[model samples]
Target chain A: MIAPLLQGFLDEFERLEAAMPGYEQAWLRQLRRDRLDAFVTSGLPGRREEAWKYTPLKGLEQRAFALPRGSALPPPLPPPLDAVRHRLVFVDGRFAPESSRLPADAEIEFLPLSEVFRNHDAAARFRIARLMGSGEDALDHLNAALATDGLLLRVPAGRSVREPVHLVYLGSKQSSGRAWHLRGLIELEGGARLRIVEHFYDGGEEAELSSVINEIQLAADAELELVRFQDMGARSILLSRTRLQVEARGRLRITAIDRGGELVRSEWLTTLRGREAHGDIAGVARLRGRQHADQVVEVRHLERDTSAEVRFRGVAEDQSRAVFTGTLHVAPGASGAETRLSSRNLLLSPQAEVDTRPVLEIHHDEVVAAHGATVGQLDPEALFYLRSRGFSETMARAILIGAFLEEISIRLPEPRFAEWVSSRMGLDHPLPWGGEKT
Target chain B: MLEIVDLHVSVGGTPILKGLDLRVPRGEVHAIMGPNGAGKSTLAYVLAGKEGYERTRGDIRWDGKDLLSLAPEQRAIAGIFLAFQYPVEIPGVNNAYFLRTAVNLKRKARGEPELDAVEFLRAARERLRLIGSDDGLLQRGLNEGFSGGEKKRNEILQMLMLEPELAILDETDSGLDIDALRLVASGVNALRSPERAFLVITHYQRLLEHIVPDRVHVLAEGRIVASGGPDLAQRLEREGYGWLAERRRASEALG
Candidate 1:
């Protein structure tokens, strides 16, 4: 009675079990089997699920995908960041030791997930068992079962890394119609600081799908800044979920930029576990053609004096659709919690659509929360003003769209990354000042 | 010359300008002094080709060319500029960049070479210096966070840079203090020449006192009810338009 797609996945898991990491560990084997069983029982999300209403998976359910086989050469990489010296590169969902530049620092543990499991690191296995499959849907369970390779990063207590660590996940040309499930774990000890830049790209232009699950834990007084950029092929689909827990006096800053892929769904779930924990999340999605992007964020204030802010800006044109749903919750007795959530979208064409929903469930009356969502066309007054100043309608619209997204792009971790984001959105027209000639 | 014949414009199905006619030959400044709701601002918007201002029946000719058929940018390229009463704030757009873009666009349309950044900035800085203003405004966002008087002054700053053939000032002195009023007037006077004409629209005659007009016209009921020399502006300032309304009512009764 099992679906054919589910049967195919099960068969693949059985065949690849010996080749997977931690194959000798009986506990990990049982753990993967239990999660796979859970996936089989639930299957792909259907139309009835409220969270999956906007993003349908019926098409994805009919297709069968297997793990990427063998190593393949990565496509041309993006230019290196000036401030980033430590690099980790993955090609075709497999770690590329040839392309990686490992860190020489002793205070940081930077290694592949396969190494962590193959070496039988008990500390990592414990955290992985505790944090995996924590999502509200079955996708996380699927990732937990099928994940083969990812990054495992840990910073010792009282240590700060001034230079950022870059992780590049590339779907090379040989990865067409292949799927990769990547799981990452990041642990920051008390008073430790670290910055990470994660980049995802499909160089082959025919990748089928990629699912990434990252679990982040920050201890007391820890600080972490994570920036992720996703630019996949037009035929590919990307599903990602990041679950984070911030303890007392911890600070977490995250920025997610989605610019490519036919379909993308990004979810960030954060729980403030201790007092004065703060989370700042900002995202931008620029989509055109028939592309679709959905971002869901939920921040829970479980302790007093915790604060969080989630802001997103989306620009959809040419029949593309962008969706943002934010939920801010204040647990009972978390009276001093404060939160701000906003999603503003611009529909550039008649066929373009955007849906934004901001929900605030404040259990405590003393908490201050402000949330707003707006979907509108460009300001007609501003448009007319620009036209009256001799700018063509196209140029005028581009300028206004650039201005709309400037607030978020300017804060990118790297200064040049802002330029890259603007160029990807086609907003990098030569200006009178910075540009030599127009 | 700029010529308008029997212009009729309506906004959102309500008529604002009905059967209006005017002409401004080159080498002259005309002041339009009218009461509120007399289509003074509407005339400026219509001339600049703003959308939603339906020109049901009108012929706007600029140097014998049909103007209404052209788009707003086309009109702007043809040397028409309107200083807004409430200048719009364009956040994230640098003032100098915007001014330079507009200037270069006009120049390119006219088959003239565009100025580079250095040349453009030098010219702009000179203009600011001549107007007794600083260069700080050029670095900020266009009209963003500007005070009331500063917004009006910024409009004049734009006019100075654009150097349009037909400049329309729509209540450009409403919220300006005397000092700002004088600075804006000087900025305008600096651009005055035989090859350009100005249409200054205002509710009060204070701006006219600084940039004395060659001709003054009183607009009422969407038509030019009276036109005379500079003395007419002084007369309206003293009489407060009471006699003009009485005269209009008398004419209506006769009809």
Candidate 2:
């Protein structure tokens, strides 16, 4: 009894299964078939499901999207970055080698997923098999069953990458009303350090649906900083999830800026698996018009002396709605684990909506956990103060909005990344403080 | 010159300023003293064009221009400034940036050339030095984590930078030490000019001792109950405002 909405995707997958990469490999074929069966059994999660209660898929299920094909010219990259040493470009979820600047260094191994499948790399196959074997839900299973291409990056032990590796996902409207799925994997060995910047943009004007899942694993003594900027077309829908695993003494920092897309659901699931592991997630979602953005985060501390912090800010204007849900869990016997989570949102209009929920579950007595969520409008006192200082009403509102999300910009590793986030959020005031002069 | 005649103000449908009248000519500093609930702050807020303080039946004229029709920012650009008793602490907004933006906005409104960051910084540093203060406050957030005295000084610093023609000090001496009081007074004294006027609102005569006023007016029952020279502030300090209501009743009975 598969739902008619997902029947289209199932049919499309069956039709293209034979041409998919690694189709001839028995194990890969079995993995895809099993995931497809899982997807069929559990269609799209409905409101009845606790995790999907705030998000409804009726708008996405109304229309069927065909697989994107044919190469279109990639749009010019954003300014403020004068040099990019290493970059991987994906057009419509398929790797575009022509637009990528692949690094030839010996300190790391970076390759497209299709290339890995073509070469029949044993280790790559094992990693992919393991990732697909542990599917969380319907969306994860669907991505596993259909994703054809993404990136695979691994940094060896004891090596620190000086420059950040840029990963660009461009949803081009060469052929309209299309859909694409991608899977990415990144691993840092013991004592390795790396920084990755991920950008999602729409190259043209058409409604496209995209889903991406990424797995990032940090070994002992490893550190990784990830910055993501998602600014796609106003009519596009995006579903993305990132799974993070950290070993002993490993640190992972994530800054996600989501200010685009008509309907977006972004999730991050992180697990501190070893002793003394640390992870922090900080992000901002600025939405206006009729856009809907949802950010869900879950962190699990499984070892002693682990710590996690999750801070998110949301600004919704017009008829837009923003939703944030954060959960922190400390496993039994995970003593001395500490966790803090907060979600603060600002509604700019009477019709705008914001919903936030922060949850904490500590099984160990020695564990420390705190969580808080607030949904409020801009401070009237702050606004009046700015107005009294000769700022126009609109200008005062903009300044207060900028200040509300200022902490996110300060946490950004690169100044250019901060500038990009500011521009997307329409915070381009003559800020006398940071960024270039207008 | 600034003038207010038969000014009646209400807040939430309750009258605060009932038939208040005041006039301050250019080149004169007038100190306004009052007890609590006498609408001393209300007058300040109304003059600065704050919202919610409705002008039910009143007319305020600033240099012969109607002032009630203007917005708060417009009134600021029109050369009126109010030093709030509680200066707002805006975290994440640098002090230098906020002041520079304010200075530039007023300048731009007057069709004057704008100052760049460097020029503004130099001017701000110079002012900071003249007020016997350090430049570190400029780099920090606008009054964030500042002490009570520091916050009062910040309000004075803004007044120095803005250089308003009619500067209204709304209890700026409420939460300051003796030294801070002198520092704030000096900052205001430096800007006193024949082309500018000061409307100093206070509850005590100590601030008046440093920034001496040409005239003193006692506001009671939302109206000027008494007006005299600088000696009036001293008499009130010694006698207190307990006699103000009785004195107002006596005057009304005589009328």
Candidate 3:
């Protein structure tokens, strides 16, 4: 039964292949077939896996999702549109280029994944195979089996792109158990530098599931900074994963912000492959009203003289729940490797729950590796100080929350993205004092 | 400007201040000198309306208005400032921002125009220079990682910005060098006016030399045992509180 369903999913891949009729390559088609086969064998992860224990796949069993059929896109993008330098809109497993704005500079290469498969077959195959779900995980396999529309960004060698690339993923309107598996491949050549921002938004109020996978590879002396924003509606379920590989002297910085969703889980796995490589992973999750947000990150220091830092902050209000699990690994012979993982959670309501865990796995004896997790309410002293300064109790709480999250916000490479995240967290308005929302 | 009549306070069910009376009319700087555990700090905290200090029996009045009934912040807005002995260190809150909030709170209460950043900076710069402190201190969190002298100077800087009608200095001289102490004292002396009053609490006569208090009161076992002119501080410095405690014991024995 699973074989046929898996084959049916692969059949959809053939359709995507046929859609790009003008440019078809045999090697690219074979590689996609091999990846689909890998997905068929792996299937969905079960309770046995430690990473998938807390998050079960019970809801996924109840429905079968089909690929979206039509070319209907979402309404025109919202205002403050100038904030995004470039945008690629994907509606129901298909790219909507008409709704996007690309930069004029030819140094930064941006195209639909389908186009990349047709035009740049070798580059696409090498990136997808090396960065995609080569691990022994079921969800990753499922994503590979049913992957459709997404983005492909490449920064040429010795070139530096000034603006950030934005990828906007929009879910379909139908209530079908349809899953939109989208993947983004960001390839930075040697001595290349770029910044990319990916946003996943759902316009419809229908119950649906969408999983997005992003793979980034930084060549020698290459640098890349990426930010992913997930702000779907309450009826949507999103499972997003990103894997990054940095080579010698390469630098990769990633920030993930989760604002709204019924159930959202994102994982980041970064590996430092060569000497002097650096990876910094930071994320913030704000949840309210029965929402669930989970972020898992792992940083591996496989070579000597490598350093990494992972920081995660979450605010849970109403009946919302948030979970953060961070791990830092330093392999043997990876001396002078310094890695730190810190996670802080703020519970805004009595019913709100936050679970944070930080793990450190070190096989090297001469390395500095530390992990810390703190879960609690706001500091009473700080709150009282703010209130005593003429701010109401509500304003006091809001200010302290902003202060707590400011540590991460200040580290954002882009100011506009930081402001956008702050606004989503309700830090834009003056705090409502005396139980009145202003 | 402020009156503490027969004030008694307790902490953790233990009596600390017993029927201590103090009156500071406008235009005078009164200093309270005593040894450790003499309830000097307690009096300052109680006057500032800090919680955790139970007032067993007392009536504190400011400008003929009952003060014990108000909250600490309310008391603060009413022009009662207490320079803490051991200032609390708050990390991540900028010093300039904290002072701005405090000043704005007082200004709004007084129905005065609040200063914006530019206006506040111009005024604060003068005050900071007057205290012999640098502008970098204003960019850091409140009292965080500050030296003892810097903390006391920051307190005086706050007083200068707020310009409270009545000020209480609780051991402001405890952790200062001679120069820092003189600077802090000069900062306080600059704010002395006929409309303002001060209650200076200290364990020694070192700071008194700078401000030159009009009267000095000695507090022992939670009550005032003696009151005299500035010479009393000189006498206490020479004779020490041991002789006074013996005389008080002898007087109690005769009674």
Candidate 4:
């Protein structure tokens, strides 16, 4: 009974495969085959996997989702990044030329993969062939198999782009119930620096199942800052994954502000492949009305003198659920590895739930690794103190939650992004630390 | 003015304040001196509207208003402030931002315009300097990682920001050194006004020496056992509560 239906699901997917732009290219054909064959064996990951135990995928099942027809007109992207002149827009996971405004600069290679390959850049032409088939993440494999169009960005050695590059992925109303996969590639060479912002939107009422995979490669002494804002609509399901390889003296700072959907799973997988590399990751989540959000972070320190720090704040209200799982694995010989993980959560109602797991598997004695997590209500005393200062109960709660989330704000590479996050979380109280002058 | 008549309070089904009676006119600093288990902290908690402290029978009138009928924040807006004995440390909340929010909320409740960040920063800097503190404490978390004295000074900073009409200092001088004691005392003295009242609860006469009270009352076994001038605190300091407890027992027996 199940075999025929599985075959049908794959046959229906062939319709989407036919509509892809670069479906006939020999290199892309080989890449898709490599990823799809692996995905076919295991199927979609389920709750049995240790890393996927808390994420339920019912919202993504039982329905046929096809590729969407791009709309002639779509709503403008949400700001403070809307005014960003260097934005590249993608509708239904395909580059939309009408909606994007691209600027050219000598230091940046911000364009599509087809354009980069046409320009005969050897480094750009071999990216997918080199990095696509190596990851074990099931979602990454699925995205690589389905994706046909996405942005490719590169920063040459010793050059820094003055303006931040922005990428906006708009899910059109016509894209309802369509499962799309978007893939992005970013590479930074030695002593290069850049900042990128990625935004995702679910533009319709019907459920949209989507997956995104970002592959990043950083050379020695490289630096990159990335901020991601995701709201997959009220009924959408998203599997977003980011994988990075950092060399010696490379730094990667990332912040994720997530207001999740019916089902959303966001993962960060990083490997410190060289000495003196560092990764700092922070995120804040607000979930309500039976929504489910899961954040997973894994850092592998394979070399000496590597460090990583992760801090997450979550608030779940109205029968919602939130999960934060982090793992810092220091190999036996990776001495001088310093890693820290902290997660704080507030459950507004007794029905709301938060599960936090900060695991440390350190095999070396010369490393400093610690994990601290707390799941509780607002401090009764602090709540009383704030209320005793003339703030109403609702306002008091908002202020404390804002203050709790302020930890992520101070560490933002673009501090102005804090305002957008505070308002997005429905916490408009006066921030504990006043907004900066800028 | 503040008045409490036959106040009876309980906590977790256990009686804490039993039939306590007290009154203070406006512009008077009245100190409640008592030993351990005398319900000194209970009095402050009840007046501040802390949960779990049930008022079984009581009538508390603050400035011609029924205080027990109001919520904690309403009581705050109506000019009642309790400087906590142990100020809580709330990480990630900046001290200056916390105070400014409190002040602006109170002002908004009273039909006043709000102050922007610049205006609030300037005003808080003045108050910080007046309290003999610096901006470093303001930049840090609200009482987070602060020393004992620094915590007490932060309480005073809030008081200075809100400028409440009635202030209850709950053992504000308990763990302070001599310098902190003088600083806190001076900060309290600076807020003395014709329309204000003070209920300073202390276990020692040392604080009274710095800010002399107009009257001193002795509390024991959940009631005001005796009342007199500042000399009473000094006498209680010199000679403990044994004599007062014996006299109260004899009076109860005779009655």
- Best by the lDDT measure: 2
Ranking by DockQ: 4, 2, 1, 3
Task: For candidate 2, write residues B1-255 as lDDT tens digits.
Answer: 999999999999999999988999999999999898899999999998888999999899999999999999999999999999888888877788888889999999999998898888788777777667887878778889999888888888889989899999999999888988888899999999999999999999999999999999999878888999999999999999878778778887999
Best by TM-score: 2
Quote the lDDT for B30 in model 2: 98
Name the docking class for model 2. acceptable
In candidate 3, which residue pairs clash? B1-B26
Off-target runs (Cα >4 Å) in candidate 4 are A2-12, A26-41, A114-125, A130-138, A361-367, A430-438, B134-136
Candidate 4: CAPRI quality band: acceptable
Candidate 1 lDDT at A73 equals: 81
> What's model 1's overall lDDT?
0.85
lDDT digits (tens) for residues A200-224 of candidate 2: 8887768888999999999999999
Each model's total of backbone clashes: 0, 0, 1, 0
DockQ of each: 0.44, 0.48, 0.13, 0.48
- Evaluated against the true structure, the overall lDDT of model 3 is 0.79
Cα lDDT tens digits, model 3, A1-438, are 664445556666667656532226665455556766777777655567677665666445545556676677575554434567677788766788777878676577777776665555564667655544455466676666566556777888999887766777888565555667787777899989988777777666777778888888899999988877787778777888788899999998887888757778899989999898999889888888888888999899999989998999999999998988898999999999999989999998999889888888999999988888888898775665454444556655766776677666665555555566566677652211111110
The fraction of correct interface contacts reproduced by each prediction comes to 0.57, 0.48, 0.11, 0.62
The docking quality of candidate 1, as DockQ, is 0.44
Top-down lDDT ranking: 2, 1, 4, 3
